[model samples]
Target: MGLDDDIAILATAPVFELFERDALRLLSFAGERRHLDEGELLFSRGEPSDGGYVVMAGTLALIPRRPGEEPVKVSRSGLIGRNALFRQVERPADARATEPSEVMRVTPSVMSRVLREFPDVAAAIHGGMAEELLDLVRGLSGVQERLTRLSPRKR
Candidate 1:
């Protein structure tokens, strides 16, 4: 694909939407592309994550660690390892290419360069992440409340 095509796909990713054209250009120039054949193992559960992957084409299946859980499908325009884009974290599930696929890998080093150069985008992304964390906390609190009510009453 051309540079414009890469940038276009990058722009479509939720987090990348915060980046400017210049930032997108830098990402397209610096990011590495990896192609996977159908049934390829992209990453395994418990593996150390190095970066994030933006699915450029085809599909992937994020298989849960628990046997009964359904695998989540990720197709074109999907972003995997979103947290790994900023920090190193162990993979929680296995990621495999369910079909021939192409993905762009953006390392934390590249992300740091982009954020350092574009403070505004960095702030925007940070704020967005903070909100997501807060929302998670709120949801957990609600769950706790429901669990408390479900507990048997003592004398």
Candidate 2:
């Protein structure tokens, strides 16, 4: 997509809507846009995550696996990983493309500046993050329930 499309998507994005134009401007100072094909790995579990992604199009899947267990598909989204823009840590799960995808990989510097310069943007990001976290908790709860149901009981 073109810059106009990017901006439009950004403008409508929950995380971007939280910020001011100047905070968005900070993104101009960092990172690059990247396109990925279906089945491509955005990142593997435990990988050192340097940035976060904003989905421009297509879908991404979060797959979770435990030791000696099969990988379980957890959640999918067209717009995700926005928190990676601000987080400084490794990803716990793997992100893979379900279709040809376009995403904005925003670096920490640009993200930090946006948070510092635009309170509204920060609020939006926090809200988006809260929702994401809740989604994750819900996902995990389902997984745990399924696992409990499937596991053999000790009697």
Top lDDT: which candidate number? 1
TM-score on alpha carbons, each prediction? 0.93, 0.63
lDDT of 1 by residue, 54-133 (tens): 99999999999889999999988899999999999999999999999999899999999999999999999999989999
> Which residue pairs in candidate 2 have backbone atoms (N, alpha carbon, C) closer than 3 angstroms, thus clashing?
18-120, 18-121, 19-121, 52-84
Q: How far out, in Å, is residue 23 in model 1?
A: 0.8
Per-residue lDDT of model 2, residues 1-155, tens digit only: 55556666666665676656655556543547778899998888888887877677777777776766545432222345555677777787888877887677777777787677777767776787789899999999999999999999998
In model 1, residue pairs whose N, Cα or C atoms come closer than 3 Å (at least 3 residues apart or on different chains), thus clashing, are none
List runs of model 2 lying over 4 Å from the truth.
25-29, 66-79, 123-155
* Candidate 2 colliding pairs, count: 4
lDDT of each candidate versus the true structure: 0.94, 0.70
Alpha carbon lDDT at 104, candidate 1:
89
